[model samples]
Target: MKSPSLSTTAYAGASNGESSERPPFLRMRGLCKSFGHVTALSEVDLDLREGQVVALCGDNGAGKSTLVSMLSGVIEPDDGTIEVDGQPTYMTSPLRAQELGIATVYQNLALVEQRDVAANMFLGQEPVRLGVIVDRARMVDEATRVIQRLRVGLPSVRTLVGDLSGGQRQAVAVARAMLRGSRMLLMDEPTAALGVRESRRVIELIQEVRSEGQAVVVISHNMEDVFDVADRIVVFRLGRKIADEERAGLQREDLVSLLVHGCRSEEAGER
Candidate 1:
């Protein structure tokens, strides 16, 4: 498949409450997006802590895609700031995001159907040994080590991503991001099309990423997925943040109420 034309976003984020020792994974404030006269995202603010999983949820047209695009550098926000690793920086493109140790696994998975897992893992950025030849052996070894590091349960490194099961392909896609030395992953509905077991495996892989201390921004519509893995839940309603709850006291329905109705009144009362 043709890779999406990736570019870096021009806006840079902020650094707040982040330490000198620890890098600020990502920060955003007053993020806004519009096309013609239609506002897609407005005044959206987000902070991604290191090693934490943040679930970004909203109904369609609620600004999830716009935020992801800006974060992943698919499109620039009309207004906002973005900071990475404690430094204010602009993600001018997907490659620039990669340079900042940020990687995004889009909903489509972006695998080349004709290639094997190793090739897929190193797509666009292939390792070289003798000037122009790919470091085939090192690529395989590193790919193997990455899957092992993530505790991924793929049967073989030689498996073609296309031939693998849906969940396995998701694993490959995520693994590719990890192998590129990404410190954070912005996943877009990773389990949207997978079977139960496949989805479960993908969940486990995400856990492994967090265990390794890399922050994650997971965008999913599945409550189960959110409740199973998120450290924080940020719900958006009509281009605005309605609720930002820690996993400690937040319920699925409470977040749903904020997302679906933008009303808090007594979301906890239902429980």
Candidate 2:
């Protein structure tokens, strides 16, 4: 496994008078979205900082997917603002989001099952030789570097992605995102539907990615996994933010209450 040789100065704080006290690496204010008569999101505000891992938690129909889609540029928000580095910007499409250094790894993994690991990693952006042929050697080498950098254990880059375990396939998707020069990674249940050990590996990989100084927003219903990797947790209910709290001094039951009842225990008590 080779190490990743990418510079993270762009996402890292304290560059050119940008101090820690300044705005977050990414910010969304008053974001709202609707489909026909149904409101998908309602005045949502969120912030993410570089090198931080935030968990997005909510039950079904809680607007988690809608919020992520807006951030990833799959769909634009009907109203609100997205700010990168404290500058207002528009996310017109997925390509525009990538141009802004935001990448999303959806739950499907999005790998060509028949393709080899290296091929899947560089699917759309393959290295070319002499402006004509695909450079197979360089592709494999770069894939090896990304796998090693993420510390994901795979037999070889030449191995088919279909033959890899669930965790390995997830790693490939993440590596593909990283190869695109992503400064912020948004993962949708990267650890879902795997054996205990495989799920553990994926969670570890998320932590490793955060260690590389990239902002990560993970969407998961598994409280255990969320507590394991998330520095902060945000909960959405009925298309609105219900809770945004640091992991510090937070209890498991407190989070469960927010997901199920749309309020903390004490708040429920008042009700």
Candidate 3:
């Protein structure tokens, strides 16, 4: 793979008195979402800092996907606020979220099976030449550039996305996020169904993205993958945040229990 030329400043901490350009580029405070009588997310507060990888952990229905959906603009919260650089903002829609530089890579790896790598990355927004023609060269060049930005290991830009390995396909999906100049990325199980080596490659690529001054939020049930890449771990249970612990201060079972039952909040009133 060709190496990408980049600057160390790509992932620098915020110095303009804004919230540190550290991990977590976005934060939701007192966020709530409901459907009819049931609540999918309740008073949830989460953060996504630049250059930091946050692992969101929980059982199947712990509102993991729902919360991210709201953050990604697939859904809008009925209550609370979203803050970027400590300033409150509204996503209203996915396009608005993209304009805010927040991107989410869904679990299905939404690349068109019929499209090649370049085609997939530039799916609906292909670069146009002079007036009315597909700028194939520019499309491929930018596609290749973004792939390297994430340090993604791909066989070729011309390769069909469907033909790539599970990990490679995931890489392509992630590279698509860069096309929007995303500052924050939410990935739903990027390593799912991959062999050990392939999973490692994807994990490494994720690290590269984080190193490039971007924030990554990973939703995974795999504790091993979480430990392998996360700088901090956030556990959710029954649509509520249970714990937000740094990786060095916690263990696998501790995180697991927090996901299953929450890290026993001392707030007796909650209990």
- TM-scores for candidates 1 onward, in order: 0.88, 0.90, 0.87
For candidate 2, the lDDT comes to 0.84
Q: Determine the C-alpha RMSD for candidate 3 after optimal superposition of all C-alphas.
A: 5.3
Of the two candidates 2 and 3, the one with more favorable lDDT, higher being better, is: 2
For residues 146-237, could you state the per-residue lDDT of candidate 1 as single tens digits? Answer: 98887777787887777888888898999999988988899999989998777877877887787687888899988877777777778887
Clashing pairs in 3: 11-213, 14-21, 22-50, 23-49, 23-50, 24-48, 24-49, 25-48, 25-49
What tens digits encode model 3's per-residue C-alpha lDDT throughout 43-91? 9987777777788888887888888888788888989998887788888
Q: What is the C-alpha RMSD of each candidate to the true structure, in Å?
A: 7.9, 5.6, 5.3
Off by over 4 Å in 2: 1-19, 269-271
CA-lDDT, candidates in order: 0.79, 0.84, 0.78
- After superposing candidate 1 on the true structure, give the runs of residues whose Cα lies further than 4 Å from its correct spot: 1-23, 265-271
> Candidate 2, which ten residues in sequence have the lowest lDDT sum?
1-10
Q: Report the alpha-carbon TM-score of model 1 versus the true structure.
A: 0.88
lDDT of 2 by residue, 1-271 (tens): 0222132223232222324576788999999999999999999998888788888999998899998888899999999999999999999899999998899998998899999999998888889999979999999999899999998889999999989988889988998898889999999988886777888778778877887878899999788888777777899998998888767546788999888988777767522
lDDT of 2 at 113: 90
What lDDT is obtained when candidate 3 is compared to the true structure? 0.78
